[model samples]
Target chain A: MSTRLLRLLAPALLGTLMVTAWYGVHLWLDTEMRFLLPTPVQILGAFRDNGESLGRAALNTAEGALLGFGGAALVGFLFAVVLSLSSLVRASLYPYLMILQMTPIIIIAPILVLWVGAGLKSVAIITFLICFFPLVVNTTQGLISTDRNLVELFAMWRTGRWQQLVHLRIPSALPYFFTGLRIAATLAPIGALVGDYTAGNSDGNGGGLGFQAIIYSSQAKYPALFATAAVTCALGFIFTGAVVALSWLALHRWHDSYERADR
Target chain B: MAVPPIVELREVTKRFGDGPLVLDRLSLAAQPGEFISLIGPSGCGKSTLLRLIAGLSPVTAGTLRVDGVTPDAAAAELAFVFQEPTLLPWLTVGRNIELAPRLRGISAMDRAATRQRVLDLVRLGNRADAYPRQLSGGQKMRVSLARALALEPKILLLDEPFGALDEMTREHLNEELLAIHAEAKWTGFFVTHSVAEAVFLSTRIVVMAANPGRIHSVIAVDLPRERTNATRASRAYLDLVADVSQLLRSVESTAA
Candidate 1:
């Protein structure tokens, strides 16, 4: 094969082998820990049997993740713009943003559920709270880290503040903002799962992937529990990868950093 | 006598916050379409004087004007090129060159023509799509020159725009600058420490001194109005260089 094809195929082959090795180990553990573990085959069978029910739960979880992720992205970007535009806004509010970021999401999710009630709203609020901080912090740093001389050149050209922000700062910050998005995309679904686990009312409408795992585990349905978890992990990977791919496609034209990496 | 000076600095002084004065009571007049070079030792406030004229900073005292208007208002017809290329790293050469007209909201077609014309002037037309990082040192400076030219500016303020380039590239750009100046006939105020460069490209050279940075003398070059590589070896060029060098030596002794 050509070097280019070899370069692309090697990583895919390595990843598949790594995953197969882990599955083998997991099957050995299933034989030892009957109630605690499930073989990959059993999990797959469980997934097939409960595919319709599981699909509905997955959709519910996806809805919460999308809602929370979109809300966080909008709020984070606006907050970054505000912080960059005014020293007063950065000084007055940034410490609080830091605090929100550092506080444990597990500790906060229960409280958010208490305040918001069970189902999509509670799950989404928790996801938004967890994912908002990274986007804001990265976007703000990227915008301010632009070249000083470029800023001066813009000033000399009589470019207005709005024009500079739109044309230069925002485009310059794309790579950083996308990095935050990738992190948040994975985290958002996990955050939603945690919220469902802690605050789900056990009603059919409220039970998502995390709640399904809890219910199956309580009943000692080990394969069903593992199956739900396998799906959640798959969701996390897919969500993260999709976001990174979307960002690369949208931004690769304007940024050399992105284009160089692609080449 | 009837024509107003293109740029005039009347007793202008500048000091950074709580620091000693860098420029004190500096006065000069740049005639229309004249090429004026300010040669001084480092820390002589030559760059500060250029910044004041560009409206990048305000004069601490006295009057600074371009075409008898305040620097900010006059800046529409002015362009400043720094020692560093300062091409926006994220932008391609063409996009960076298009910045000034783009900022002014000129029509897209006119902006494209301006970008192409300026790049052609700087001989960077083929590298329009290349990013700044991909270009050589000389090429980056050409993009900066193209950016300055895109405005079709009336006053080109160059703050040692060629200082970072190699001697060969610097000489190449110096000739290119003269050609552009000849075609456009803009008032050019350039700051530099290179005596040969000043003598070669300037109509009048202002020799400046440090320690409260003031103008020591102005020497008018009487070289043939046409300049080329051969002019660097001319007797008039060497004499002007010697005169500026003597003024520099005198300033050093006075500082001592």
Candidate 2:
């Protein structure tokens, strides 16, 4: 098959295989333990029954993830630029940034809920925290890793520093930025879910997918829980697909990374 | 009658970062419209010399000037083609050609006109919209040349610009480069390891030794003004290449 057709079909094929295997496992299990495992039909029925509630939760999580991603991108890029502009700043500030990145977000999330109080904004902050470092590291590396020969060429032309940053550095930074964004895409939902579990309303519609996962499991509605997980996976796919689509738009024309993907 | 030399290097010395000397007390000069090629082994610092002439690197001592001004001050009059293609892969051919002049604050109209003319000069006028990744090796080098030309420079500094190409492409681009140089009438300083290329394209070839990279000998090429493949196939061109090759061998042995 052509690369495009393969790309389009691969996910659907994988999802179908996964559902089939889940159904198989459910059938093989002892009847006494079967109550803990939801069949594909049961999950589908749950989705049909509670579609509105789950979708609202997905929407809330999606909004928080989107906001967090935007904020992460903006702050991360600015921090990269500021740090990379001078070796002194990069040296002095880099350790602090690394420490921030290494600190456990799970432990911090509950404290953040207590400090900032609970809402979509708090979850968004947590997502931003998770998404920030990769962008900063990758963008900084890109900005600094301009080919030495091109650096000389620009220097020979006496192209000013601003032009170097805009024309040379920024264009070089793009593929790296996209790689970092792809990584952040996967991490973003996890962050949003963590935020929701710790801080979102436990009883209300505002608790995101993570909250839904918690609520359904506690209530022992195994089918809805399974359905919630499958739906969450779908939401993750949609979010990542949005990022991949934007990456295709931004980089398909020139970057080798996207060029290979096009193939 | 004597026209002033376009470039003059007097007792130039260069060392790097408290390391050993790269070029030591070296000196050379180029007149208007002369193609001078510097040939030496890998460690001979020939590329470093080109960088010094382009004002991309500084000399430790002595003076280097273009049109009787400091290399840094004369930057606007000089354009360099590196050993690599060096075209921004993200940019279209036209945009890449337009870039240097724009960075130099050239007016948009003038940049556009020069970009068109050089693209046409390099026989890439139709491919202005083509990105660097879409181009072949030779076409990318043509874009590199066109980029240099857009600056309307008086002197072109090329550091083995065609060295990366295969032999056939290299020879073809060599001819095209001579034609472009003849038409534009810019003084050219080229660095190459290939003696045949140096002999074929240069009015003068300067052989340099390694370990303090200084000129060992200079040979004046005796080829027809407008070189063709016939020039390469000619007895005199073969003799000249062989002669430069022998000189290069001797230099390499002495350096070793």
Worst 10 residues of 2 chain A by lDDT: A198-207
Error of 1 at B236 (Å): 3.0
Tens digit of per-residue lDDT, candidate 2, span A76-195: 888887877988989999999989999888877878878887778788999999999998998889888888878877887787888888898888888888778888888888788888
- Please report, as a residue range, the 10-residue window in candidate 2 chain B with the lowest summed lDDT: B97-106
TM-score of each: 0.90, 0.93
DockQ of each: 0.51, 0.75
lDDT of 2 by residue, B204-245 (tens): 998989998888888899788799889988999999988888
Best by TM-score: 2
Each candidate's chain A: what TM-score? 0.87, 0.89
Provide fnat values for all models in the order shown. Answer: 0.57, 0.77
- What lDDT score goes with residue B50 in model 2? 87
The true-versus-predicted C-alpha distance at residue A169 of model 2, in Å, is 1.2
